[model samples]
Target: MTTVELQRDLPADPERVWRALTDPAELAAWYWPERMAPAVECDPVVGGAWRIASAPDGTAVGGRFLAVARPLSLSWTWRWDGEEHESVVAVTLAPTAPELDTPDGTRLHLLHDGLRPEDVGSHREGWVSCLDRLPAHLGADGSERA
Candidate 1:
């Protein structure tokens, strides 16, 4: 299986970043494509379930949390609305060092595994776009956090 890994540095603390990652309302704001109001339900606990309905096509994706480490890491099993095959998604957050551009920011790392090689490019693009919007969702002004 192919694994898609992405890393991003955001101008926000780990707590803010974690909320943007796990909160359903915050996810609905930027997780899907722009202008699409996807319905989201997130149960932020180990073994808790979550689902996201695509507004554009009405496709539903559901998963169960495999691990939950608040403000630090989360992992879950991922599958489409009707698909049987499952993949895994894990997110890790860490504090940025003072030498980095966003010194007090958070470093976000995402790993999506068990995907078909052909699906990697599209998933990567989608994730990159979503993650790029996270800072704005966190009320960032594109400047270093004080």
Candidate 2:
């Protein structure tokens, strides 16, 4: 299995980043496509089923929360039913200290694990696209690392 970790320094605060990650509206603003549902409905608690459906075509992504540490960390099962694909996505938000070299902002660490070699390219591309849109969606120009 292959794993990919992506990191980004967002200009927004931890709470804002958390909201963007968890809140339906904020999440759609960045992560969801225009035709997709504007709001995501899911019980974020551990073992709770989480589902995100896209509009127009109605393609959906399904998963379950494996862990939650509100505003800090969230680990969940991720799957794409149309493609019959599954993986684990763990996200962490951390506050970095003020420094000249370091970007002063919230750090978003994403770990996408258990991907097959053939699926790696697609998964990486999807994440790259997602992160590319996050800055404008959050109203902040942040730097992302893949």
Question: Which candidate wins on TM-score?
Answer: 1
lDDT of 1 at 100: 93
Q: After superposition, how far is residue 24 of candidate 1 from its true place, in Å?
A: 1.0
Q: How many clashes (backbone N, Cα, C below 3 Å) per candidate? A: 0, 1
TM-score of 2: 0.83
Model 2 regions more than 4 Å off = 35-39, 82-85, 100-104, 140-146
**lDDT for each residue of candidate 2 in 1-146, tens digit (9 for 90 to 100):** 89988998777667767777777666767786666654576776899887777767667787899999988899999887667668899999987667723355677899999998998898898798888787676664343311
Question: How far is 121's C-alpha from truth in model 2 (Å)?
Answer: 0.7
Candidate 1, residue 83: Cα displacement in angstroms equals: 1.6
Candidate 1: residue 21 Cα off by (Å): 0.7
All predictions: root-mean-square deviation over Cα?
Answer: 2.0, 4.1
